[model samples]
Target chain A: MKPIIEITDLYFSYDNKNLAINNLNLIIYEKEWVAILGHNGSGKSTLAKLLIGLLEPLRGTIKVNDKILSQETVYDIRRETGIVFQNPDNQFVGSTVADDIAFGMENQQISREEMKKRIDKYIKKVRMEAYLQHEPHLLSGGQKQRVAIAGALAMDTKVLVFDEATSMLDPQGREDINTLIQELKNDGDKTIISITHDIKEAMLADRVVVMKEGTVVATGKPTEILKDETLMKDCGLDVPLTVKLSQELKKYNIINDIYVNQEDLVKSLWEYSLIK
Target chain B: MGIQFDKVNYLYARGTSQEKAALIDIDLNIDLNDFIAIIGHTGSGKSTLIQHMNAILQPTSGVVKILDKTIIGGRKNRDINIVRKRVGLVFQFPEYQLFEETVEKDIMFGPLNFGVTKEESAIKAREALKWVGLDQDLLQRSPLNLSGGQMRRVAIAGILAMEPDVLVLDEPIAGLDPQGQKEMMEMFYNLHVNQQKTIILVTHDMNYVAQYANRIIVLNEGRIGFDGNTWDLFANYELIKKYHLDLPDITKLIIDIENKLGIELDHKINTVENLAQALVQALGGANHVR
Candidate 1:
């Protein structure tokens, strides 16, 4: 399949400051869940903004759906690429959930009936039907996040970007969003690029891209990238809990490889015990 | 000599139609130099409960003691300056609170307002910047010029410059990258370890709380549901699950080991490296055998 999103040597910097993203290159396959990981100020957000033309790159190009991303195509890019930001309060423009979902469809010039249909579809999709009439301020952080997801998913964009979307959520809320993201990936042919500080969340992605000092340092399966002790330390991170547990269980020689999921880790431990 | 909450109850939008209890009959004591981690599910009133620590919201029907002064010292008895100075509450996304032109000026604002001399404030600002791992050169630049993580550090540095006795942070690493999250935690750990400053952090990372915190306080439904040592919190998996809390995946892994292999781990495992080392030890020093 042709790559859904392609970045060719993209370079971006603040209008009045130094380069934030430098010589970034990647090709995101359609329907792939890719996570972008980096240290603070490493240009992950800039790269996300660059991909969707939220911030114009100082150089190079971004192509989504095989269309070049430029000023002329910025609106179409936005129309195709949806971004859910970190803070729920900032992304929302409407006072109520119903109005918030309606805002996007309204901007897209979607018909009222079609808008309601789409709104109902996504609100149900995110499981926030009851909160459709609640004020944004009245909702908790996780509720607001679900509403944000509803707003983003309502647009039916081909590419979904989570800009640290689950960072504010409590563990349970984070799990809720994580499950939702996996469901969305399983249920559709959309591309998901989540920029996050959560290593566990990154491990759930199909591929992990590590960024350092405004550059792409490594890209591979999350297990390969995360299990590297040198890399994890250099990136100022610890291995994911599941991986750590497997490594810990190795004391009893119960598990061999470092897997990032509890089910797999447990199954491996049981098998190791039988062999022992 | 630190902070105390005695039968404290807090309500949001108090006396209004939207009034709802945010915190219910809470009696807790956090002593000087205590590093406490506050954990809870969403809508559990964790945020609102922390806001009361510094008089951001006084108790609606109870008493909050901070640095020997009660927030509800009465309508005519308000010690705003002392309350604000003694407890530095770093709100979620402190970067948004940055309005000063330069990073150094922003860091100096709290200290200067607290009546520190110009030279002393600058020294404090520099020290705070170093603690957060931000370069001294960046102090001359606008806070808006810094990166997301850098801006976050600058905001934190501003709070640290105040040199408060108690530091409370609400989801400090909520929007950071994994590396940034680690750095922020290390900085916070150092703040408590080296400086002996009382730290109360509100975070959702169960694994992080397990590894770093001395005490874990779980809030549920605007009330203190669980409070104990971090190990005990995880040791009682039933209680953790009852309160909608999760253990570090590693701890769960250990539990799985006991269930499936009929062998229980004798030692607590929190870090991957420590677990890996312990595993090798349990496997009879497998230096010669892979």
Candidate 2:
């Protein structure tokens, strides 16, 4: 439960008049998967930028691995953090998947032999070893994202952020990425932050932080945060379908408690059905 | 006027080794005022099919009749602009294409390009703004300075200003939040219901298809795999699996509950409310539960 990323009294504004991140405070523990939910212009992306040293905060501090983010330590901070963005077409820098992955490690002054070995190991980890030589343009959106995740993992960063990563993908592609995230969580070694609009994606997180008007409105377990329809609406999100069903059943006294996951809810309903 | 596509075949990089067929033997008859949802996997020729609606990409070996215009493959056609003006195709993430300094100017740009008078285009701009549920005060603001959701609405307003008969939206709500997605979908649905505008939407979200679209057209590998009512499309579990399509979340939940509880629930229920009612009835009636 060691804090890996700590933000204190963070403030940032793009226009110098309106605050994008207003007095925000948060701490992400090591090996924790936190999903940040917010509507557009709620400053989710700004926070992601500030964390990896892409944008300097106007006030307060962001500490990654206990090192405060500043001009001098920005490079050191960035080396330990990696981010995969929304658009897959814009993130490619190499002619092939293998080269794109090696590009990051090479910047760290890793030797050719070690770089090759790490690339091979991480590519297989993300399940993209078969498409090692495929061009970026030839790969599907889901495949490109897998490669991106592979690239980030290849860097051996402690903190990995996905900024609306699966938003642009198809359902199957999204499933693949979500599965990869689950596997990464099971490994319990890297801290993952997913900023997404999909409630199903947030349901997979260890913690959920809901933002509205550039500030944290609610923070708790995904089941607790997502079950409150009012808070979800305030943050411009819809409750997941399973939760809605459970709530309705609860009102009719058909079920005693609300369930977030599909399987558990269905199981509860099945047990209830056997009553009569 | 409706659109008619006849055995259309489109090939990219034609006559080269790199040439690939993007659309093949496509025949579709889209009536006026039809709300159709086009769906399939990525790279399933959905984009290529919609691009033909506005002559953005003409077919290689077939005929396309849009409104009063006819485009024949391998033949000279000079009315591409006329077809484009009548069938407005909004690309995915269309906000990225917004470059005008002001929102008003951006919306008017399309109408002005089509030879509308400045005064007339201004009027159209305000009307289009209303259509997309934006305030008139935003007219003077820079399009780039607005939030992502506003920028997207302004981009759609640009298309509406053109007064197109057929509105084709490509993944219009892909990156939007849950509420933004609901708002945009409602806006399109209103345009279809109240304004009598034809909406041909391309989306990966079957939830929207189940809720809004009356008709569904599924494409697979540059060909039409299924074309029919939404109910008929979702009824076949095998077809849905074969196309790698996902059911609406509510529908999926209902099917899961039926299987887990060993009860027969209606597969046509697409909303949470209806699903709850059905579940209660299946699990020994609401009266019995009470």
Best-performing candidate as measured by lDDT: 2
Error of 1 at A191 (Å): 2.3
Assess each model's interface with DockQ, reporting 2 decimals per model. 0.53, 0.72
What lDDT score goes with residue A224 in model 2? 93
What TM-score did chain B of candidate 2 earn?
0.98
The residue-by-residue lDDT of candidate 1 on A10-87, one tens digit each, is 788776477788888899999999999876677888888787787888888888998999989898888889988888
lDDT of 2 by residue, A151-248 (tens): 99988899999999999998888999999999998998889999987899999999999888777888999989988888888777888888888888
Q: Which ten residues in a row have the lowest lDDT in candidate 2 chain A?
A: A267-276
For TM-score, the strongest prediction is 2
lDDT of 1 at A198: 78
**lDDT by residue for model 1 over B69-152, one digit each (tens)?**
877623544656778877899998889999999999999999999899999999999999998888999989999877778899
Candidate 1 — what's its lDDT? 0.82
- True lDDT of residue B217, candidate 1: 90
Worst 10 residues of 1 chain A by lDDT: A247-256
Off by over 4 Å in 1: A15-17, A232-237, A242-262, B71-75, B273-290
